[model samples]
Target: MSVRVLLVDDNPVVRIGLRSLLELDDRMDVCGEASSGQEAVAVASRERPDVVLLDVRMPGSGGLDVLPALTQLSRVLMLTYSDEPAVVSEALRGGATGYLVHGAFQSDELAMAIIDTAEGRPRLSPAAASVLLQGFHGGGTAVAEAPATHDRAEPTVVPEVVKQHALSRREVEICRLLVAGMSNGDIARRLFIEEKTVKNHLNRIFAKLGAANRAEAIATCLGTRRGA
Candidate 1:
């Protein structure tokens, strides 16, 4: 079945543009549209879309405000113009599957974000990823546009994943690199594994952590590891 999508943006023009772009992929079908956060929730409840393209600047109930609720029903990839660190951190905390700054994405990037979210692999634009790392780690910014390719630095020690989760040694290593803000390609090259292998490991990692995507995985790891 095509991945059903619900488009939520205050502007009709933006929603139409997204629909046109998403429909280009035969695997995606634009199932509904909503002009506000409340409307988006209502339509999403009725349509039960697999993914939701949600705009952050909606007039009445803001996107972040509805994010915790919307995420319960469908994968939500935030579409916003803001790149502020606080906003990025809050959206992820609010259960956004991915965050993409508007106008930064080409059609392919946007489609990949939606598809990845539906596949339970969170997609973060380089910029979005950079900011989140900064917010969480107080680390320097990530090169947001680093060619989707990039790295093992010093062996950052990761606490053992909860034994009940049954994470392997290599999975724990990969999770540490992910916390270091490495991309799939980066992680694969560093570990001398194929990119597809990195993705497969990530899928298993998410399952073990009870996470829906990379953002959730990162949050879960951070929440648990910080106190360790």
Candidate 2:
């Protein structure tokens, strides 16, 4: 089936270009377009597109501002020209489904991104990956549980709930950021990844944590922290 999509950006030219580029792919369909956050929300609600290609900055609602509004509408791919970590992190925290940079990908890459976005994989600009890698490990050695020094033996078993979907190192990193209240954009900035990549990481985290939303994920991790 063709993947349905919506374009949300203030720039008519950008929207037109994206529409043309995306329409060339037989597997993708441009169902609608909205020039502002409010318009995007309204149109998305009505059309219920499978994904939204969103701009990072808009007139009244920046990428961060329109996030909550689009939560129920569709998966969002934030497109921006800036690679600033701060901006990336904010979008991620606000719950963007993916992040992309304008002019970062060619037609094929963009097509692949549309496919991946449907599968819940995040697509980021190549440079964003390097940024995220730096952010992931730069935060000092993850505080591991210390071995029992006295008579008591430390539990070696992974928690029953979380054990079902063992979190990878990347998931762990994303979890730390979520618990820290960093937006996906911010996490992307800190990690030097695109905000979209952060979203992908977060999808893994949600599965591992058995969480439906960020708040639940945070609470689950924090609950464990209290015991640790």
Candidate 3:
């Protein structure tokens, strides 16, 4: 079955371009389009799409304002121009399944992101990943000042905040790998555990950390949240 997607952006040209790009993929079906946050919610509630491609800045209620509602309706992947660490962190905290900065991904990558998000996997573009890693490293800067690659070196020791969360040793190991940008499959292979086992650990980790998603969990662990 084709993955139903809702395009939410204030720009008509952007929506049309995205629709045209996504239509090239046989696995995607553009279910609806909305030019504002409120309209996006109304259309998504009606269409019940598998995934929502959301823009951060809109006229009335921006993407952040309506993010919580949109997330409850469907998996949301932020497709925006902003790559600020704070904005990325907030969007993740708001329950976005993935973050992709505009101009940082190709059409094929966008299609893959929609599919992955619908399948419950978080996708981060290189720029977004850079922001998260910079936040993880306590670097107060934008993506332009950070490295362009997601191959940053993993921390040698887990942060004390993670210990405060009382995560088990294995869970700590998983969190370390996650901060290093390893996916569940990659972490599973690296730790010699099943992917399902990794996910189970992550669930417990998130619960303990009071995190809504992996990004939030990492932010909490590293104490990288902007106003925390």
The residue-level lDDT of candidate 2 at 72 comes to: 67
226, model 2: CA deviation in Å?
52
Q: Is candidate 1 or candidate 3 better by lDDT?
A: 3
Q: 15-45, model 2: which lDDT tens digit per residue?
A: 8988998888899999999888888989999
TM-score of each: 0.59, 0.58, 0.59
Candidate 3 residue pairs in clash (backbone atoms < 3 Å): none
Give a tens-digit lDDT track for model 1, residues 164-189: 57778898889877766665655777
Give stretches of model 2 more than 4 Å off: 134-228
Model 3 TM: 0.59
Q: Please, what are the lDDT tens digits per residue for candidate 3 over residues 171-203?
A: 888887777666565577788987668878989
Off by over 4 Å in 1: 135-228
Most accurate candidate by lDDT? 3
What global local distance difference test value does model 3 have?
0.79
Please give the distance, in angstroms, between residue 131's alpha carbon in candidate 3 and its true position after superposition.
3.4
| TM-score of predicted structure 2 | 0.58
Instruction: TM-score winner between 2 and 3, please give it.
Output: 3
